[model samples]
Target: MSDVDVIVIGSGPQGLAAATSLACEGLTVLVLEKADHLGGAVVSAEATLPGFVHDLYAMSMNLFVGSAFYEKHRVELQENGLEFVVSAHPYASAFPDGTSLKVSTDEGDTLKMWRAHSSADAEGWQRLGQLYDDFTQVYFPVYSSPLPSKSIASAFRGLWKVRATTPPAQLLQLVLSSTRSFGDRYFTTPEAKSLAAAWGMHLDFAPDIASGALFPLLELYGNMRSGMSIVKGGAGKLPAAMARMIEVRGGEVRVGAEVVQIQTDGRKATGVQLSNGEVIRAQRGILTTTPLPNLVNSLLSKQSVPSKMAEAARTYGFGPGTFMIHLALKGPIPWLDQELSDVCYVHLAPYVDDLARTYQQAVAGILPDEPLVVVGQPSVIDPSRVPNPNQHTAWLEVRAVPSEILGDAGGDLSEISWDEARDIFAERIIDKIERYAPGFREQILAQVAFSPVDLERVNPNLVGGDSVSGSHHQQQLFGFRPSWSLNRYATPVNGLFIAGAGTWPGAGVNCVSGPLAAERLLRDTHPSKRAFRRSR
Candidate 1:
């Protein structure tokens, strides 16, 4: 007998969203989390000190704010004591030359900031800003909704109409072109180009990568419209909010419960067998997120997943790893650029070439001598991030490692000590930060580090600290994410499905994959209620 209508494995953003949506539909839902809490990597916190909330992984919810998932669920989250906050001026990237580029919700103000760096770039910046605003207004809704490619097509048409006023080919060039090559199309100056390059590199792809140009505009929208906000107290607030929502809707989230295997009846998934030997039954088993290989070799038996499927999963690559440093400072970081004081996020790369080198080094299994570090003072934006004014926290996220580096490229994460590696990474970051911000080393009251190894140990889905869930390459995106030519969320197994960052709409705190999975589940159980198209 089924105890619940659906059992969702993993309580990350996608899993949480899936569970919440299904629960709201009056379906009995049960969420299982390996960790003792919710939010997966999205809302994790590691205490480097007594009162500092070091975001274990992601530092901000900027991407989530760009999604309608947060908007639709904002009232519910706030009622549960979760408040999403943002800064007035979202992000600022600085060069050693002291020149900088800033963005804000106000398009005109953003133009002024860009103008300070280059008047020519200022015009291009204004145009791009308006284009981003238009794109967000039109495409963001379809992105938030669980709509298919037809909806994307419709949104593309709307984008075309808006871009028609500009050069006819500009829209196509921006969307389809490489950020490294096409980035120059928007800006002429070096600093302006560097800013755009760094923005696209957020996913860890180099500027020359195809469709990388599209990310800069998306990043701009997310940062300017909504500054990265920390959940009050810690990053875990987001997951807590999801758990509260689920409980209020008559669902339950069981933490410290590791799902060992998916029980299948040859043609369909019946339920899950926990690591501790508890067997829970459900009408539909929804695995909200997981890498393809683990889902095959670890969760399902050989018969359930064919050899061809396993082979395809084997060929799929996990993305780059992030070397993170969390600092509990004795005092606030004193920046040479006073304007940087209020900044929540900082990308410390002098040139586009530097950003490229960082990624190149990572692919080669080496960290750059000079890494691309994203530094943030969470306490400045959220008072509760620190225990007192005397105490402050800074998160330094660097891109320069691979998930498979720590162990035998194929062994499980148990083969390494991620915690120790994290300490080494923290030292390098403090040294780098001291370069621009003098006496920065003196302000350190406490410090903690997370290597790619540490990230994987903390969350198995992270897979060697590759935070974007899986590689965001073209073949791995859309319905092909986690694998090409497969409807990821809806697996071949009848009652089994996939979710999490490894699914479509690919990683980040964005809940598209989760909510989309829920919509698919709803459609699967009640096909006539909602319609969805399969990949063509």
Candidate 2:
């Protein structure tokens, strides 16, 4: 007999959501994760010092909170131990000239902040706020939803729903021409454009890409509506809440129980073989987080997946690898601009070309001479980060490190040890931060760094250390994600399916993959339930 109704692998945001959705249907479910603790990428820890909880990866859950998930489950989750803290100021960014901009919760206050830089920008800033306000109420939902096809047709229709309220010509220009240069258009000054550009580049190495112009709208909306939010304990707390919810419904979570192989019998997968010589049968086989090509090449029998599907999986491209630095600072970073004092989010890229070059270097195997860095000072938003009053920890996401930089030898110069590579990357990043925050380097109490190689070491699903699982380019979106025909999460194997950030609405803390997989599983399982009733 089958072991359970469904089994979800990984306890990332996606996995937890899948478990929760399936559990709600009264299906017996199990979730397995390799990490000792739950929450894959969204984890928190005392990496810096005791009592000072540091967000392991991302500090902001504004996107998740602004989403329908929070709207529907906020009260339910809070009762189950989920709590969040929102900061008044979302972000602060500094240019080389010693000027900085801070985004405040109040629109007028934010406009005043911009007014200090440019009078015209004060008006432009107001327009920008309106854009995000409209977006929060409209555009974001469409992108977050399981709307079929991210086609221009879908985009335009989504736009039409809000078009009557927005300035048609301006909105159309922003949507279609957002790629030309977010900083060059709209505001006459670089300060305004760069501030706006900050929102666009969060899509992990977006650079100066064309289609991303609309992304700034998301950033603006997030900052305006919720500011950056810190889960009560840490980023991991969010996933932990989801896991708890699932468990409360009688679901099980297994950690360090890796599924090494799919036990298939010629045409269908009957169960999964664990690395430790045990097998778990799946009466209703489903994988809430499976990397297709990796599965086809390693776990599944060659005959199971069609040659074309295998080819597609092999050809599917994941975006650039993510390199991060976690630091336990000796003291808070002293900033030149007082406005940056309470800032939670900071981006370090002066010119658009410099930012694009970071991506170019990353794609090519070269460590950026000067990388575009994303720094999150969660302690500023959540004072409970560290035990020491004077000291706090910070996380920096350097988007410029190449995937090959961690290897012994692949390209330029010679191969270096992982330790050496991490140290070298950390030194360079700290030096860059010192440029803006002059005494920053001196404040380092302790620091740890992770290259794409280090990220891959932790989660194989994050192939080559890519955070997005796969790229969301026009060619890879929707049905084309992982593979076109395999869009429903079902594989050629009868009971097996694929799920993860590698699927549609590619990557993020969003539960799109999990809920979508659960929905498909529910639909597929209904037939079996009816047949079982007939048999009885």
Candidate 3:
């Protein structure tokens, strides 16, 4: 008998979700994590100062809350010490001129905010809201289902059911439109346009990139409908709860277990060899949640997979880098528009033109003069993150930074290394925020910044700090993700599967890939299903 039914490599959300599913289904599972801590990007720490908790990466639980995994295991996870706090004000945007716009769960409040900017844009927002209601009926099902599967086919059939309500042309446009095009088509005012377009940057989608409109639409409207959620204490709590759940179900999660090689016999994966030289065996299969590069290049032998599949994995593109600044604050961010304090996230990219410029500059290896800043105010939503009620924390995300410092667009830090320029760039980001929120710098009790290089050091899955793991560009999305050959979450190596932010429905707190991958493995390994297939 093998050591375990399945050996999950990586303790990220995806891996944990898969292991949890398998464990609950009566399969023995062992999760191996290289790092001492679980929750790859979903970790929390007192990074800046003692007693001030900050989410290291991926603070938003909105997507995870809406996920199928959560739908199935919400009660068990909650019972296992998982608690979520919802924010009524999901997101907002702060402009250079001290004006800001916010999206609220209340439709009337959101409409009033839009109308204050432009009546025509308000009407456009209303129409978009209607479209969102109709489009999600088709989109969500397809998004949650596996690409090129019977479930996805069933999801497509939903399109036919909703065609009378939502025209096929509109859906096509949503799939193909750029953020700039989508914004221009929907809203006339710069404020309204920027509010939606800035979200594109969160997914490495520049304003002008084709097929970039979908994410912005989804984020803007999705938050408006369901608000936002954060783990009760910190992001780390969710993964800890998952680990506990797995343990209670008789599965094991081992940290500091670095899987250096996947030991295979013929074309079948047998187990993994740790860096320490210990080999752990899996009876049924192995699931890897590591990035695609590590999966194909570092873990597996070149001869194990087809040449084309290996090349595709080798050439899998990671998008622009992300810079993070975690600030321990004496008090709340002193926003010029105080309304921003109540919201979960405040985007600091002022205009669509600025977003396009920053994205282009980063892609071309230049530091942006004005990078898009995503200001996350977790304390406002949940005060337990701080030591005292008067204290606060600010999670600042600076997007579209170059992985390698080639040149600074501002021309100052061109010669300096990221190690040398991290603080300087962080100050530039703080200054940008200060322009919108005066005295913002004064509230900072302590600050810790991570450059693109630092993020990669923290989580190799981040590659060059492309936090979304890999780009979600049209060619790399849907069934074409990672590659056309391995998009179904299975490897050319039988019984070895891959799933992560690098795979389908890429990125975010959306925990779709894990459970979907587990379902596939279960179906493939089921005795009844196998017998039926052989009979056919």
Best by lDDT: 3
lDDT of 3 at 360: 93
Q: In terms of TM-score, how similar is model 1 to the real structure?
A: 0.91
Per-residue alpha-carbon lDDT of model 3 for 292-336, expressed as tens digits? 787888898777867877888777999999999999999988899
| Distance from true location, Cα of 527 in model 3, Å | 4.5
Model 2 stretches astray by more than 4 angstroms: 133-138, 147-158, 165-180, 406-418, 528-536
Candidate 3 wrong stretches, greater than 4 Å: 527-536
Q: Which runs of model 1 end up more than 4 angstroms from their true locations?
A: 44-46, 145-148, 404-421, 527-536
Candidate 1: tens digits of C-alpha lDDT, residues 408-449: 221223334545445555666677778778889999887777
Query: How far is 306's C-alpha from truth in model 1 (Å)?
Result: 3.7
Per-residue accuracy of model 2 over 1-536 as CA lDDT, tens digit each: 23987878788887888788889889888887877888888888777556767777666777577656667678878887778888888877788877887788887787777788788877766666666665545455445555354543655665677677675566656655443365565577766666666555555435456556776766764676567777876787788788778888888887888877777777557777778888887766667586777777877777777777788778988777777888887778887776676778787776566667666776776677767688888776666677767777788987655677533221333456555677766787788888889999888777777888888787777777777677666567656777786776776666676667778767677767777778777776676774885699
Cα lDDT of model 3 overall?
0.89
CA lDDT of each candidate?
0.74, 0.72, 0.89
> TM-scores, in order shown?
0.91, 0.90, 0.97
Query: What is candidate 3's CA lDDT for residue 280?
Result: 86
Sort by TM-score, best first: what order?
Answer: 3, 1, 2
